[model samples]
Target: MSVWLENAIARANSTSDWLSPIRSVSLAALKDTPWPTRKTEAWRYTSLKSLERATLSPSPSVNQDTPEQIDGFESFNLVFRNGEFDLDSLTQPLPAGLMISYLPTASEEMKQASLDEFSQIKPGRHLFGLINDVLAQHVVRIEVAEGVSISQAIRITSLIGLNSESHTRVFVKLNKGASLTVSEHYQGNVESLNTGFVEYDICAEAKLEHYRFALQTDKAISLGGCHFKLGERADLNSTLVGFGSDLSRVDTDIIYDGEFATAKLNAFYLLDGKELFDLHATVEHAVPNCTTLENVRGIVADRAKAVFNGRIHIHRHAQKTLAELNNRNLLLSDKAEINTKPELEIYADDVRCAHGATVAEIDKHALYYLESRGISRSKAQVMLNFGFINELIDQMPNQVLAEWIRPQIRNRFAEMEVTR
Candidate 1:
């Protein structure tokens, strides 16, 4: 093992008291799994050779503070820094029938029960997830009791400072017939990086709406994975909006274990400069009459690179399954790059499944037409780019989040002129 890995394992063993048995098992998985390389089929587009080549030391704790102004809608908030939960900053008197607490603060029985379910998940298959499993110090837990529907959204903000590495684990559970909206916001200093894993379970007839907004610094790197399981008649809707970073990757995996479940996944990303962003997702339909739809779009500018890999699987017993996947990319510069693959694996002939992928440069004819109409080239380009991504962003159920993301898209396009 590399020195960094060895040191991380030693630290994990020393601090095992603070970790659950399942977390300990995750550490073992990390030790066995090798770092990803070009040889790996799934990682061919994302070369982790540079990350393996560098020696990364453990980050030192610095002045941890949150901005006074969040510049957005008000809601119940949970903030964390450097993998440590800040209880003082959290909102008081959580919604009725809802519980939010740090894992380490829970009783031994509750912690162990949660760990039992958590440990069963396999993290060794993904190198970044394994890293998070070993290094995370705190785990955030959110539980919604049966028949409770939270009127207000719950927001989780993860902030990182310069030269620091933060790892975190999150678990969200919705009891039978419960409903909730959860939003995760990730922001970091120019020189900081973070890696983490999130696990979620939806009980029978429960509903979960999840949104992730990743606005990271130009020099930071982030790696994260989310695993979800849906029960009978459960519903899930997920949307991800990301602006590129030096290096960033988000992986999502969802499994339908019971009949009549439904899921929708939508994502939009804007990449510029030398930034690299990737999104990988898999949806598995194991029972009959499940439905899934996935759509992802990217706007690449300058020399930045982006990738999308989506897969939908239908089991032999999953008759009457309906699934569709599509990915589209708009390249603005000659040097910009995008790689997309849509895959479908079906075992039931009665299922309906389709996938499509496309990558293309901006339409010069459209730009010329706009220029002939006396519009500036830059303004025309922004208009076309906005038109490319707005379709997916408009699907967000939260108008507040949609409005907050619009300016980000425009500002990113404005900054691209300098970098290009």
Candidate 2:
């Protein structure tokens, strides 16, 4: 372990409420697992120099009077400032069948029960996850009882301010036949380090639609991941929109624990300048008749770089499984770079799975066709580029979400020059 991490852990031990066994487990894992480098397949195209060279510490407390709201959307909001939950900003009187509690305030019994549930989740050999276990300050828990459906969305926003580091954990549980829509937003105004981990356990026949927005400044460094386990016939729809950062990585893992589970993932990224964005996702089919579909699209401009890896695994007992993965990218400048890999592993002979990837630039003929109609070259190029991602944006679950995302993309295009 690095001296920096050792000191951080020592400081965390003085105040941590986690049981001794959990702390020991994290420390041992940190000692045995080496930090990732370019040689690591999962991190081959990404560099860790920026994160390792900086001094990272926990963020200070924040007091915000009012939570940020989405215009025209009647939603429940939870705000986290500088890695700590700002209870003062939350709306009172939570919806029926829903409970929202902070770990630091919960009783000992509640903390222990949450620890038990958290211990069952496997972070797939990520060192950052172990680090989070050691230093996370606040754990947010949300539970939805059986047969409950929330009509309004639940919005959770993470705002990082100044030079600080934060590790946050979230736990979500949905009982049988329950349904919920959750939107998570992450933003930072200054140079900072942020680590976020979320685990979702969905019971039989539950439905969850999760939307994530990573719109951080160019000075931020962010690492975030999500793990999901679905029970019998459950349905999950995950959608993500990411703008570039100095260094950012997002990981997603989904597994089926019962028969006939289904998961669909859709993602779009807009990268420019010298920003880097890395997205790694894996979907596992452990039971029969499960289906998984993943689609990712990206636009790279200037000297920005992006990495995408999508994997689908079908276990031997997972008969009659159907899965597909696709990644498509557009490069707007000669200096831009994109690395994409789509993979499939099927041990079941009865399963059908496929994976494909493509990277290309704007078509000159299309630009010329529009130019022949008396449109300016720059305007025509912007129109063509916008059309590339229009289909994906149209598939958003709600108009409010789409309205929230489109302006960012349009403003980005208006400020930059497009090249063939």
Candidate 3:
């Protein structure tokens, strides 16, 4: 075990809560879990050296950090400044049918139910996830009532400061026939460590639109996950956009628990300098008559590195399932590296599933065609790279978010200054 894990175990053992039973299980499992290395299949291409060497200490309870604002996107904001929850930042009087409560102030009934649901959707295969299960202090629960549609989205933002180590958790439940839109944002450019995880339970006929932005860069080390469980006839649409950091890794899992459900996921990333980003996704078709569509793309420049492992599992009972995953990456520098693996595990003969991955440089022919015009070579290079990821950005359902992110992606290209 790494020194970090040892300290985490000690810290987790030092505290006890009403959910101690649940935390105990995680703490025990964490003690038995060994530190991951390059030999670990799930972490084969991503290194945790940055985390192991990071200093773990108590962070300030509050900071002046504020969440990012979207001009046209109206949302109820919940901010976590440093490792502490900023309850004052929440836009209160949450509309009817919506409830937001934190661990420290949850009602007895909420606490009881939270114990049973915690970690139920997220698989235990993740090493950092287990640590999150144990060390997370800022646990927030959000629920939407049955048959209600929340038009205004709820935004959860975590702002980390320099040399801080923090863990945060979110649990969202969309009851039967409920509809909601939620976004998770993590923005920190300083050197720090953070673990943020969220789980969603979408019940029968419910719908959820989810977005996750891990935009932290530079020496920030962020490990997080978003896990979803879809029930009968449920619907889920999720979008993820990220910029690379020293050790930025995220795991996303989509599980179909009931029949006739649908999930669509799209993710894109941009890496520059020595930053590294790793994305691991798994889709579980545990029932019949389900459908899944996933698209992932990335651009790596300079000495940056990116890793993608996407898997779609079709169980034996999941007949009539349609699942497909496609991952494509662009490496603009000779020293830049990308490792992509798209996998399909189908035990049902009646299922249709496909997975593929490709990593390559920008098309020279396209560059030449653009240069044939009056476009400079450098300008042409940025255009080609931008065009590759713009396809996915254009697919974002929220035009407000898409427009906000488009210029940021352009600014990233300018900073990268990647050349042929």
Candidate 4:
């Protein structure tokens, strides 16, 4: 085992909490699981050398860090600064049918409910996820009552301080026929590490609109996972946006457990400097008549690297399943690199599934068209890159978020110009 994993195991063994029994299971599993290397199929393109000898500072000096402000986005915000939950979030009045509980101080009923639901949805395959399970002491659970529609979105933000390491987890559930929206945001810089994971259970006929933004950059190492299990006729729409950092890896999985359920996932990552970002997304069709649509894109520049692995799996009994995945990439510089794999594994003969990937540079025809219209070459490049990602950004159901993120992407394109 690498020094980092050994240290993690030690640290995990030192803690005792209300969830100790559950943590022990994961801690044991983490110990037995081999450290990944170039030969590991799941981690072939990503390296963990940065973590092998790393020293962690578990606690941060008191600082009132907060999430970035977005104009006109009204949300009930749950903020974690250096992995410490903000008490103000609990003081705010919540809308009916919404319940938020912090595990450490939860009531008996809430704690019992959380005990039953925690760690049940996310698969045990992720290394960082197992680390998160063992080290995360503070847990948050959010639930929407049956048949209720929540108009306002619930936002969860994790802000990591410099030179600190933190782990956090969240569990959310939507009962039968309920509707809700959730937004998760993480930001850290200056040589910090963070692991955050979330799981959602959507019951029959429920609909959930979700967004997760891993916006940390420049020296931050962030790892996380988001998993969902859908019930009969359930609908899920999810968007994940990633910005490259020193090392950033995120895994997302969607499981269709009931017939007629549908899921749509749209994701993208933008990288600059010498940063690295890896995203692994999986969609599982375990029941019949399910549908899935996934689209992922990336832009790499300035010697940065981006990795994508998109997989769609259809079980043998999942007849009439429809799934498709498309991945596209644009490299801004000759030194920039992208590794993409789109896979479709179908066990059912009647399933309709297709997967494809493409990697290329800026479209010269489009660039020439813009340049001929009197736009500067550099400006044309920025415009072209912006247009490449804007299609997916514009599809964001929340126009406010789309408008908020567009300018940032445009600025990155200009600052990190790539020479083909």
Candidate 5:
């Protein structure tokens, strides 16, 4: 590690508590691991040198005047200033059958148990996750009781302040027959770094729809990961929308802990103005009679670049498992670039699994047809781009949320900025 990184680690350790086992694990992991490069299989297309050289600092306090409604859409909001939970702003009573508790405020028993839980996940294999675990000062834990179905979505917003590095861990649990939807929005204007880790533990017959929006300024960088474990007959639906970040990446892992579980991973990303994005998703079918569908679509304009890697693993015992993975991208400019890879590792003879990836420019023939109908070329391009991602946007559960994101997508394509 460089001197700067060593100093940053020291600063993180100083403010962090003497949490059991996590401190030792993190320090050792950081020492043994070097910054990722193109040689790393998982990061072959993305570089982390910008993030490694960052001067990390704890977030300073800022005003808490959060918006009650954004774009005329409202939901139950849990705002986090920097990486710490906003206790003062989140004083309202939680909805029925739902509970929100902060890890720093957790009881002794719960704190110790969190260590055990962290060990089980073993996030140390990934360098960023290890760093977050070792230095995380704030963690939010949400739980839904059995047989409870929440009507309103729970939204968590993490706002970065100034030149700061925010590390956070979030845990969510749903008991048998419970269902809920959770949305995570990361927005900021400062030149900062945000590292977060989230875990979802779903019991039998539970359902969860997890949505994420990363709409940071081009000066910010974001590194995050999510892990999901599903019990028998449980289901998980995840949708992600990303835009306007200097560098952003989300690594996700989904595992089936019991038979008959299902998972759907859908994402759409829009990048322009030299922005960058990377998404790595993995699904493991360890039990029989499970199903999975992974689909991602992206549009790259200007000089921006993006990467997508989707992998599905079917174990020997996971008979009758059905899984499909696909990645499609549209490049609007000659300078824009995308690297997409889809892989399937199946060990069961009785399973059907498939994966495919495609990258292409807008269809010329279709564009000509629209242009011939008196439509301007610029308007036609915007219409076609919207049609490309409309399927994924339609998958969103709420119309208000979809409408809120539509303008972001529309504005990106309508601008049609291309560099000579």
Candidate 6:
């Protein structure tokens, strides 16, 4: 084991009313999980050597600035800074039949309930997920009672204020027949690195729509994992959009536990100016008649690098399962890099599964045609790149968020300073 892993294990085993089990599990997994190195197939393009060299410590105290509100959405907002929840900044009330509270401040019943499910889903499979489980301090807990449907969106924002390391854990549960929408917005100044973990549970017939926007400054590093479970006939839709960060990785894991479940996962990433971004996703179908679809698109420019790994698994009993995975990337500069993999593992004979991956640069013929028609080369390139990701962005149900993200996509091309 590396010296850093030893220290992490030692620190995690220290005193705390909570996190003891997490520490034990994390420490046990340290010896088994593979280190993310150049030789690792899944991590071939993303090297963890830099993280291995840096000494990581708990973040320092931080006072957050006032949060900026978005129009047209009356949301219940929860704010966190440096891994600590700021109760005073919360503006909206918890919906009827729903409860939202910080884990450190939750009641004994809530704490016990959370602990019961903390390690229920395996986090050791992913190195970053294990690291987050062992190191996260504050946790946001949300519970939706049976038969409740919340119309308002619940927004959670994690902002880093200084040059330090921080971690966050979030747990969400939806009872049978419950429906809700949750949005996580991660933004920070160019000061520090941030890491986080979020887990979700959906009961029978429940529905959940989750959207995440990660926009950090150029000097920041962010790593996160989303683990989820779907019950019988449950429905889940998730969209992830990332634009700004020096280095970022987002991993998602979804499992179907009951029959007739459906899930959709869509993601878009834009990187420029030496930024490195990665997305790893897995969908497992354990029951019959379950369906899953995954689509991810990325644009890289000016030495930026992007990686996408997508996998779909169908168990022996998962008959009649249908799954599709697709990953596509567009490179605007010769120096830009992209690595994509789409994998499918199936044990059931009556299942339908397909995967496709593509990596290419801008089409010179299309650009030349547009430029000949009195359009600037830069604008034509931007238009083509935007069109590449627009296919997925159009799937977003919230118009407000879709419009909000369009400008960021345009701004990324503008920052590249590419001209005809």
lDDT of 3 by residue, 221-307 (tens): 999999999999999999999899989999999999999999999999999999999999999999999999999999999999999
In candidate 6 the C-alpha lDDT for residue 76 amounts to: 80
lDDT of 6 by residue, 53-136 (tens): 654557476655655667776678888777778877444556688888777777888778788888565446788778777877
lDDT of 1 by residue, 223-301 (tens): 8877778899999999988888877889888889888989999998989888889898988888999999899988888
Tell how far residue 134 is off in model 3, in angstroms: 1.0
Ranking of candidates on lDDT, top first: 4, 3, 2, 5, 6, 1
Candidate 1 residues lying further than 4 Å off, grouped into runs, are 18-20, 53-59, 67-72, 119-124, 417-420
In model 6, how large is the Cα lDDT of residue 235?
96
Q: Give the 10-residue window scoring lowest on summed lDDT in candidate 1.
A: 48-57
Q: For residue 97, what is the lDDT in candidate 1?
A: 88
Q: Give the TM-score of candidate 3.
A: 0.98
- Give candidate 5 regions above 4 Å deviation: 2-4, 16-18, 53-56, 61-68, 71-74, 119-123, 418-420
Please provide TM-scores, in order, for all candidate models, with all chains considered together: 0.94, 0.95, 0.98, 0.98, 0.94, 0.94
Clash pairs for candidate 5: none
Per-residue accuracy of model 5 over 104-165 as CA lDDT, tens digit each: 77798887777666635424567778778777777777889999998777888887877777
lDDT of 2: 0.82
Misplaced by over 4 Å in model 2 are 1-3, 61-68, 89-91
Segments of candidate 6 deviating more than 4 angstroms: 1-4, 31-34, 53-57, 89-91, 189-191, 417-420
Predicted structure 1, TM vs. truth? 0.94
Query: Which residue ranges in model 4 land beyond 4 Å of their true spot?
Result: none
**Candidate 5 lDDT (Cα, whole model)?**
0.81
